[model samples]
Target: MEFKPVTHVLFDMDGLILNTEDLYTVAFQNIVSQYGKDYTFELKLKLMGSQAHETAKIVVSHLDLPVTPEEFIAQTSKEFEKIFPDTEVLPGARCLIEHLSKHNVPIGLATSSSRESYELKVNKRHKELFSLFPYKTMGSSDSEVKRGKPYPDIFLVAASRFPDKPKPEQCLVFEDAVNGVKAARAAGMQVVMVPDPRVDESLRTEATLVLKSLEDFKPELFGLPPYDD
Candidate 1:
C-alpha cells in the first residue's frame, strides 16, 4: 500500500496502550454471569471502542440482562475500582510514546474511556508515559466528542487540539479495535492497527497498516522518527 506521510498522531487507549481489555472482560463477565448470561467474544467485539454508556446498553441488550444501562455501569464501575489500578502498559507502548516525544512529534490521545476511567488506569501506574501527550480527548466524557468510535468526532477533535491544528490527512492514528480504525478512516486519517490475536482477519482489512503488536510498528513508514535502538 502507498502510505502518506503524517505530521501528527492520535492514539486510542484501552487495549491499544493498556492491557485493560481483559480486565474489562472479567468485570463484565462478573455482572452478566450473575444473571446466568455469558459475555461472549462476538459481543465484546461490538463493545470495543464504544462509550461507557453505549457499552452498558449493548451489554444489557445483547445478553437480555434485566438491568438498566445505568445500573450495569454502577456494577462495572465498582469492579473497575478494584481491578483498574492494576492496569499495565502494552508492549512497545512506552518506547514508542517516548520516541515520539523525544523527537518532538505532535501526539495526542483519543480514547473512548471517560476521563475518570483514564485516570484510574494510568494516573498511578503509567503517568509519566501518558503525560507525553500534549492533550487527550476522552470521548465518554468530553462534550466536544458528541459521538464515539466508528464516528470521526473523537479523532477530529484530538487533531484539532494540536498546536498546529493539523488536517485529518496529516494525522496518523494508532488503534486496536475495528471501530477505532473505522473512526480514523472516517476522519480521513491513516491508522495503524495492532489488534488482539483473537480479532478476525476480515475485520482488519480497513486499517492503513496492521501489526501483531505495537512493537512491530515501523515509525519511519509513517514519516515519524525511527527508534534509535
Candidate 2:
C-alpha cells in the first residue's frame, strides 16, 4: 500500500523511546508477587498502552488482586521513583529525534504517561532530547484525551497541537504496542512499530512497518531526509 508523504511525526514514550518497560515489569512483579501472581508478557501487553488508572484496574481485575486501584498506583509510583531516574533512552531514539529536528520536521510526543510519570522517566536523564519535541501530549493528564491507546484520542489531539495542524494522513506515528498501532491507524495515520521481540508476530500485521529497533528505521522510505552519517 502507498502512503502519503509524511510531513509530521508523532512518538510514543515508554517502550518506544525509553527503556522503562523492564522497570515496569520489575515493579509489577515486585508488587504482584506478594499475591502469588506472575507478571507475564500477556499481562504486560494489556497494560502497555493503557492509561494509568485503566492499567491499574486491568491488573487488579486480571490478577484478582486484593488491592484497590489507588493502592496499586501508590505502590507502583514508589517503585518507579526508585528506578525511573535510571531510565535510559532507547538506542537510536536520540539520533532519530535530532535528525528530524535538524531537518525542521514537525515532531511531537504522545505518551500514555501522566505528566508526573513522564517527568520522572525522562526529565532527569534525557531533558535535552525530550525538549526537541515541541508538542508533548501527556494523554493521562490531557483533558482533551478522553480515551487511551486503541482509541484515536491521543494521536488526534497530538496532531492538532502541531503548528500547521497536519492531517492524519500527512503524519506518521512511531509506536511499540498493539493498541498504539491500532490507535494510530484509527486516526488515519501510518505507524511504524518498534515492538518488543516477544510480541506476537500476528499482532504486527497492522503496523505500516515493523522494526526490531529504531536503529533500523529508514526515514527516506517515508520521504523524510536520510541520515547523513
lDDT of 1 by residue, 35-67 (tens): 999998899999899999999999999888898
Where does candidate 1 stray beyond 4 Å? none
In the predicted model 1, the residue pairs found to clash are none
Report how far residue 112 has shifted in candidate 2, in Å: 0.2
Each prediction's TM-score against the native?
Answer: 0.98, 0.98
Runs in model 2 lying further than 4 Å from the true structure: none
1-229 per-residue lDDT for model 2 (tens digits): 5655799999999998999888999999999999999999999998888999999999999999999999999999999999998998899888999999999999999999999999999778789889999999999999999999999999999999998889899999999999999999999999999999999999999999999999998899999999997
Backbone clash tally (model 2): 0
